[model samples]
Target: MKSWSVVTDHREWHQGDLALPSDPRAWYQLGAVGGWQVVVADTPRTVAHDIVTARTTGRAGQTAAWCSLPFAVPVLCTLATGTGVAALQTAVKAASAEGLPLHRAVVALTVIGEGRLPPLVRAAATMLQSQVSAVVTVPFDPHIRAHGLAQAERLGRRTAETGASLATAVLSAAHRAWGDPLPPASVPAAVSAPAHAVV
Candidate 1:
């Protein structure tokens, strides 16, 4: 129901050098300040998996068994363009058969040339809508030197009618999404600190 954004690199994702905000609190604060939910992570898949796993389990893990808990909000997974729609559909169908419970899907519009939101995006959104709670579009570019925000806004507006969340990726060194909003009872009393903790 709320608009959200996730900040990650548009180029290849490296596990150790993620350019994101520093902590979980910072991530929540950014969402609060921007009046939109924000998801920050070391990698896009990690973030997505965190959300999915958190929904299913109170904690995060690398295995499917870790995703046994039920998800509170809709869970979205990235389906970048050029990955072949048929492959995606097949994967989706297989996941469905296995009862993976993926709630939604996202596609990055930054891949399109000339900063244009093509019909393919809308069509994919439409198709995926029936299978998931919503289809979101993220305006991302590794090079956001000029017209980045403007392009994101334009794509967002174009897809507004589909009831999907519109978002853009930003690079921050001090804010990041940690497994907050965890079922209160599930949180441990002395959890380990984040990797980028301030000394």
Candidate 2:
């Protein structure tokens, strides 16, 4: 069985953080508030940039948990644009059609600045909340102005490799933690028993 381990890149940050879940259930519970969820396509790669820069590898699952809440928050980690929004809408429709709980599905969009943010962030944010007082939307913190934005830089680069690695790591860890291996086998009913014991 594969276990989630950390990867590091020393040149990045002095703080070499290990990507572990402080609370996986918390992440999932918070995410469930949203109806359906997707992360920006390549989430691991996005975190990798920082890892590469920092010279460290984190347990892949921990990093993914940190990146976004997939079960609760459908992440759309893409460059903010008109096309991105359209793609997001399609994903939302599909998730909804597939019977994902949409009571409060929040579409999290990644953006570098005021320019690229999809015009629909405002529109999408309120979608669930307005319809069913139970729903709400959350935008990526655009105003969190960092002095030297290394974390922010990598946060936007979602790609297939990163996404797959991160997802595998998380699920692998979850399965291991939950003891999800094949069940035990049963004895044959035809086997004979001791006569004294039967009596």
Candidate 3:
């Protein structure tokens, strides 16, 4: 059996320099937030390296987390666009080489107006389905949060049977994939009531 760990790029708001989450739950929560890209890996070192590299390429103060699951379960690589398909494939290949299972591969699209899953996103999910245990879609549009949340909920329910899931503001796809327990009620809600209902 394999153990899990997490390395996060998030920092608390304070007067001093940045601070990382000392607890795995904190890392999980940060990754669960909307608009952030999440990638899970079988090996901690590789995932950490990838996340660090990815973050360095972007702007500063960009928060992220590298979580290790409780078991040597499947990896859930959550990407944002079509451009990330190649990276997903590479990560899958690497995990296979290391004999680590992949749970799900999710591609989050930040587009408005949704009916069925987009063809390109569908193609990517289909392509990775064989490599991973499942493939999921997260429809997200910051401008229209409610619609995206509704679409995500529908997709999550539709794909639940196949071991796939959706990403929402209240409940993220990463947390669902990781099987992380729900946060305490004392914790503040991430989204409004209408949006929360969708997840």
Candidate 4:
């Protein structure tokens, strides 16, 4: 069975298969009634102009367990947006019109870079990193094409190139932060499981 995410209006933040209370205007605060201390700000990539950061002190699922030289990754999750929700609702309506189940309707959009998936993904990462200082958003390049689907694809791809770009970026960030182990000359040569993509 597929897993569906539940978001409680402006009280919680959730993004998965099927969002509960599929109201397009349902905005979540990213941090909810949990042990997490969420503080929303601007994107992490723009610390030069403005600074938005979030951190987890454990007791929550938002901590980016740092790998030191492998990027200061916090517990990564997808972001949602008004546009993304509208697109999702459009898909849902189409599915409903076709007499398909909610999952069946939503599956078509889950494919990365297809239809509304990218916007939703981008929105999610932006919102997350904006809130938590430790989080980040990987803007995938056309050539690199980071992992957009399942962990199975990220791990089992023969080329092992799915999340290579993101991993490379993380490793580079790690190098910058620690300044050791020299840095990767190439992506394929450097990217590896467990060490590369933290997902």
Global lDDT scores for all candidate models: 0.42, 0.39, 0.44, 0.31
Segments in model 3 whose C-alpha atoms lie over 4 Å from true places: 1-18, 21-69, 72-75, 103-120, 143-164, 167-199
lDDT of 3 at 194: 62
Candidate order by lDDT, decreasing, is 3, 1, 2, 4
Order by TM-score, highest first: 1, 3, 2, 4
RMSD of each: 10.9, 16.7, 14.8, 19.7
Candidate 2 local Cα displacement, residue 165, angstroms? 26
- Judged by TM-score relative to the true structure, which candidate is superior, 2 or 4? 2
Per-model TM against the reference: 0.40, 0.31, 0.38, 0.26
Q: Model 3, range 1-199, lDDT digits (tens) per residue?
A: 5333444333332334444444455544554552233424222234434544655676321112322433223344444455556566666665554444344433333334446655765687787766654454544334234332234345444344333333342134336554677433232246755645545
Query: Total clashes, candidate 1?
Result: 6
Residue pairs with colliding backbones in model 3 are: 5-68, 74-103, 75-103
Model 1 regions more than 4 Å off? 1-66, 69-87, 104-110, 140-185, 189-199
lDDT of 3 at 135: 54
Candidate 4 local accuracy as lDDT? 0.31
Model 1 C-alpha RMSD to native: 10.9
Decoy 2 TM-score against native: 0.31
Separate clash counts for every candidate: 6, 32, 3, 8
| lDDT of candidate 4 at residue 8, scale 0 to 100 | 26
Lowest lDDT block of 10, candidate 2: 131-140
